[model samples]
Structure formats: structure tokens, C-alpha cells
Target: MSNLTARLRASLVAALPPEQLLPDSQPEYVRSYVYVFGATTLASFGFLIISGIVLALFGPGWWHVSRIGHFFNSIHFWSVQAFFFFMVLHLWAQFFMAAWRGGRGITWLTGAVTFVVSLGAAFTGYLSQQNFDSQWIAVQGKDAMNAIGIGAYFNLLNFGQMYTYHVFLLPVAVAALTTVHLLQVRRRGVVPPIPPRGLGG
Candidate 1:
């Protein structure tokens, strides 16, 4: 076991050298405003997570009735809006740049998957609101879930289940996927600039 653990540690260090994982400086190409969107998305997501934890700790009534809870709820809500806004900007920038090029395909795929999973998290969040708005959304959304034929397992009307997903499952998935995507980026580095016209890519 000691030998195995040493080998594992050695392998991990080799795969993720300190310089590669946390470089002192980034490449000149990475200074563009377009690249800034990715970091902005992460900032918004951090706020979403902190506010979400507070809101979850206090339960639905606290968020609905208490002033502090309302403050946290508002924080969570605005954070969600900012998160999606910046995430979309980042995604679109990556798409336009064809960020999958030059061996970054898996990085691109992980980011795309994270975005899709985040959408589910956002939907379930609305269902977990436990308000009249949540009621109407749940009623309307359940049919869509049913039409897809996973209603038995993913019933949108079940507040408990939806809350579990919004507060736990989907968020975990998004965080994990985003972490993996960032790791891949740290390992593989950022995509290079496109070549000028008539200069082969």
C-alpha cells in the first residue's frame, strides 16, 4: 500500500507540475477581453454558491418571510442571472473562436456539458422556490418532463425531489464538470489565435 501510494503521488505530480497548474504568467494571446468572460462566469458562480448555501440552510419559509433571508434569496437570484449571463458570453466567445481546435476538443466538450447541466439546475431552482410562481412553473414544466418520459424519476412537482436536485445533485454536477474543464485548461493551456487569411491554420 505504501508503494502504491507513493507511485500515485509521483504520477499526480508529474501530470500536474506546479508551473503548469499555476503559472506565474499567462500567454499574451490570453489577455483579450473575450477571454475575460470565462473568469467573470466563475466569479458569478462563486456568489451563487455562497448565497445558495445560506438560503438552503434556512429553509423555504426563512427565505420567504425574513428580511435577511430575503436578502440572501435576492443574492442567489441575482447571482444566477449574472452567472448565466457571463456563462453565455463565454460560451459564445469560445464558439466563435472555435476553441476546440488544436487538441482542446475535450475541454470544449466539458464546458458545453457544464452549460447544459447548469440549465437543469436553474430550472429546478425555480421549482424549489416554494411560491405561487414555483407552483405555476411546476405545473407547466411537469408536462414537458412527462412528455420526455422520465416523469416518474424526475417529477417536477415533487418539491422535495426538486429541492434535492437544485440544492445538491445538479449543482454538484455543474461544479464537478466546471472543475474538470478548468483542470483540462490548466493542463492543456489556452487555445492559440487563428491564422491570418491565406496562412493555413
Candidate 2:
């Protein structure tokens, strides 16, 4: 296992050119406020993970009954809300800029898929909160799941079940999808703006 790990690490270092990993210089055109959105998304993701760890450490049981737990839970909840909100803005801006064109279509498509999955994960997280709001959303959301024949596989009323998915299943899926999305983005590099027509050499 150690040998395999070392070989994999070496392969990654070789595959990723140092210039691509950290360039001694970058294009001047890349300098703009719009470019900051990607970094902001990364920052928000960090916040989500840290807050999630804190919530987990407190334990779901503690989170509901204790003041510190409740406060941290609120922070986690709002952090998720903020994460999705910023993600939407970033996705929309990227779309309008036609940043998906050229060879970047795969990166854009992966990101779009991630966004959709993230929404479901976020919804499930809320429903699993096991609060009054959770109860209301669970009842409301079950209809659609039932209508679509998915409720049989997922029980909204089971707090234990919902909590398992919220902390484990949904997060694993989100993280896996996010990993793929980030890899695609890194491989493709950031897309440049479309050139004006008739400027072709």
C-alpha cells in the first residue's frame, strides 16, 4: 500500500507540470474582479467543511439540546445557505461570460451537475435537522419524493436515517462530485473571453 501510494504521488507530480501548478507568471488578461468568484467559492467550501466538523464534534444529539450546539448548528445551517447562494452567483456569471465555450464544456458541465446535486444534498440536510422546520420540510418534500417513487428508498420521518444520509451519504456524494468538478477546472484552466469577430489571423 505504501509503495502504491508513493508511486501515485510521483505520477501526479510528473503529470502536473510545475509551470501549470504554479507559474512564474500568468497572463495579464486574467487580472479582473470576475476571476475572484472561483476563489470565493473555494473559501466558502472551507467554511462549510470547518463548520461541519464543529457540528459533528458536538454530536447531533448535543446540537439540538445544548446552547453551544444550537449556535454551531445555526452557523452550519447558515454556512450551507451561504455556500449555495455564492455558488449560484458564480455559476450564473460563468454562464453569461460564455466561459463554458471552447474546450471548457466538460468543466462547465461537471460544475452544473455538481450544482444540481448540491441542491439535493442541501435540501436533505435541512430536512434532517429534526426541528419543527425539518418536520415541515420533510412532510412537504415527501410528496415529491413519493410521487417520483423515491420515498420507498428514503424515509423522511426517521431521524436516524435522515441524519445518516445528511452527515455521510449526501456529503460523500457532494465531495466526490466536487472533486471531479475541481479536477476538470484545473485541467482545462480558466477560459478566456470570446474574441471579437473578424479579428481572426
Candidate 3:
């Protein structure tokens, strides 16, 4: 047992050194507004998760009928909006900075995957709302989903199924992908700014 534990520790250390896992400092270039957007995106996601949990605890129908529930619903709604807003800024900033330059392809890939999954989560949330908007979206989305042959397993018209997806499965996927993306970011450290070009020789 001791030998197995030692081997496991060694492997973990080899993959993620203490310095990389918990850095005390970062490069000076990391202070820029562009770099901050990534952190902002993460903060927004955290808030969205908290607000979503509150809504889930009270049940979906409460949000439509109770004053407190309505307030939490608004919070969840705006948090989703903020999450996407910050995420888009982060994506654009990383693209311009060429974040995948330092053999960080997996990091970029995970972030992109998280964004795509989050969109699916947002769509399911809309479907689970049990409101007129949800009805319209489901009616319209069914055609598109059918064209892709995915409507059979994923029925957008089913509120219970959509609620389960929005509150459980999709959130789990987004959280897992975000965790992996952050781990890769820590492993690689922040990407450096492009150096200024020299005057023509």
C-alpha cells in the first residue's frame, strides 16, 4: 500500500508541480485588461451556478408565482447573460493574443468546448422555463433538431427532461470542462504578450 501511494504521489508531482498548481506570482504582462477577462468569465460562471442552485431548490414553478422566486429567477437570468458576455470577451481576447502558441492547444480546445456546451445549457434553460418564450423556442427548435436527427432522444418540448438537462447534466459537463481548462492554464501559465516589432532595417 505504501509503495502504491508513493508511486501515485510521484506521478501527480510529475504532472503538476507545486509551483504550477499554486503559483505565488505571475508575469508582469498578465496584469492587462485582456488577461482579466478570463477571470471575469470564471467569476460570472460561478455566480450563475449559485443562482441556478437557488432556483432549482425552490422548484421551477415557484419562480413564476412567488416574489422571492421571481427575484432569484431574475438573478439567474442576468447571470447567464453576464456569463456569455464575459466569455465572448475572453474568447476574442485569447484569440487575438494567440493563447494556444505555447503548445497549449488542449487548453484552447477545452475552453472552446466549454463555450459550446454552455450554449447548449442556455438553450435547455430556455426550454425548461414553462413559459410562452419556452413554447416558441421548443416549437422552433424541434425542426432544427429533427433535421440533425437528434430530436428523437432530445425532446425540446418536454419540460421535465429539459429541466433535468439544464439543472444537472449540462452544468456537470460545463463544470468539468471548465475545471480542465483551468488546470491546463495553470500548467502552462499565462501566455505572454507579443513582442513589439522592430523598425524596418
RMSD of each: 1.6, 3.1, 2.2
How much is the lDDT of residue 165 in candidate 3?
A: 95
Report residue 128 deviation for candidate 3 (angstroms). Answer: 0.9
lDDT of each: 0.91, 0.78, 0.91
- Model 1 C-alpha lDDT per residue in residues 1-201, reported as the tens digit of each score: 369989998998887789999988887877779888999999999999999989978886798789999999999999999999999999999999999989999999999999999999999999988899899999998888899898978998889999999999999999999999999988888888888899884
Q: State the displacement of the C-alpha of residue 196, model 3, in Å, after optimal TM-score superposition.
A: 4.6
Query: After TM-score superposition, what is the CA distance of residue 141 in candidate 1 from its true location, in Å?
Result: 0.8
Local error of candidate 1 at residue 201 (angstroms): 9.4
Cα misplacement distance, residue 124 of candidate 1 (Å): 0.7
Q: Measured by TM-score, how close is model 2 to the native structure?
A: 0.86
lDDT of 1: 0.91
> Candidate 2 or 3, higher TM-score?
3
Deviation from native of the Cα of residue 85 in model 1, angstroms: 0.2
